[model samples]
Target: MTDTVLVTYGTTNGSTAEIAESVAEVLRKAGLTVESLPARSAPGAARYDAVVVGGGLYAGRWHKDARRFVRRNRVLLADRPVWFFSSGPLDASAAERDIPPVRGVQRAMKRLGVRDHVTFGGCLVDGAKGWVAGMILRSGKGGDFRDFDAIEAWAQGVADALTPAREKRH
Candidate 1:
């Protein structure tokens, strides 16, 4: 009865994907079976016992694929333990204000009764591959504000929440 957790993300310049991988790694270390995948390529939600979906914030909106993935899997996600995260906001102090998960995300969360949602600071490398990312970096507003410790701690919390079910089955 071990829970299989799906860690999927949508990203414009790869930062969110990195965050998803980190979360998956932490969950794996905690003894959960985890799968890290892009939202666009994610398999059926029925294949997992729990789900953690994340995406990059762009102009106050989540990556479209992330939103679409949730929409397509609404039935399955609604019946499972689902969580969400957002990776964006260059200013670490402004993580809450800069990327509020948007109204659409909020609505989806409410519908699915999502467990929790977190917002983490994002990365802005000098030569990011996306056009919008490159423009933002060139504007002198790009800097790495990701807090790995916070991400790890959050993943640990997720593992904590999911572990009880496994223990019960044993």
Candidate 2:
């Protein structure tokens, strides 16, 4: 049987959602059945064979929706293969090197036995919501920092890891 994968994320300004979509696209190309949804609306993880959860970072914390989703589905997630991602550094540091998850995310990953996690550069463009975003933009520090190449490479790694298990199941 083919494995069904869920790529779900939480985003305040939509950048993280795009990153999740890229992940889903790569998984689909790798021949897995995949679904991408915002964490606020995604269904429980029980139906998926594996999962990729992502959230935009804010004030050194994972988005509330993403945190809640994991909390709500802890049992199911702990039993399955799971990966995580964070997008929220408006700089090239994420593409340049490994960025560890924040304290809350690190604790959650340990609790869930998550397989892996990656931090991708974030995007903050004109018209992003929030006063902080506005301030950053006004300070000339806002722009699209997401590296599609790096994101694709990381996603391919996830696909490579899952494909073997999927083939074994066949």
Candidate 3:
């Protein structure tokens, strides 16, 4: 059977889920079979040859379901390649503010032996989301901050990583 890769992620307002779908598309284009699924709806971890997990940041933390998925499959994950990413810290402007959530995510990735990790800016629309999300995104900056180019680049990178080096060469 052809090897399979899993693209799994959790989303608060669906941005991360879109990113995961992008990743899956890139992998599929490169000839690798990929299944994009929400963390909650995904097959148990370790079932695929390679795995990419992503999540949206909520209150400075990853979605609970994403965290649980990693913790539950820590061992199997350590045995194979796993990539992690967090969709967060959508810059409100050149605030020169706090560090990105990716810093903490990196630490977690290291412990899990994740092959790679990334943090991408996301978007929020005033009143478009639920009350909690709306309140947080409203009084603050509200706009679509997701960068499609950045998303595509990340997706391509994942596809490249999945390809054997020898095969990557023309």
Q: Specify the highest-lDDT model's number.
A: 2
List model 3 lDDT by residue over 1-170, tens digit each: 35688899988678888888988888898888889988887877666888899988877788877887787777878887789878766673312333344455666688878877767776676545678677767677566766667777877887787788426453
How do all the candidates rank in terms of lDDT, highest first? 2, 1, 3
- Candidate 1 pairs with clashing backbones: none
lDDT per residue for candidate 1 within 8-42, as digits (tens), equals 99987788999999999999998899999999999
- Per-model TM against the reference: 0.93, 0.97, 0.85
Worst 10 residues of 1 by lDDT: 92-101
Q: Is 1 or 3 the stronger prediction by TM-score?
A: 1
lDDT of 3: 0.76
Tens-place lDDT digits, model 2, residues 1-170: 35999999999999999999999999999999999999999999989999999999998999999999999999999999999999999988998899999999999999999999999999999999999999999999989999988889999999999999898878
Alpha-carbon runs more than 4 Å astray in model 1: 94-99
Candidate 3: deviation at residue 99, Å?
A: 6.4
Q: Is candidate 1 or candidate 3 better by lDDT?
A: 1
Q: Report model 3's TM-score to 2 decimal places.
A: 0.85
Question: Where in model 2 is the C-alpha error above 4 Å?
Answer: none
Native-structure RMSD, model 3:
3.3
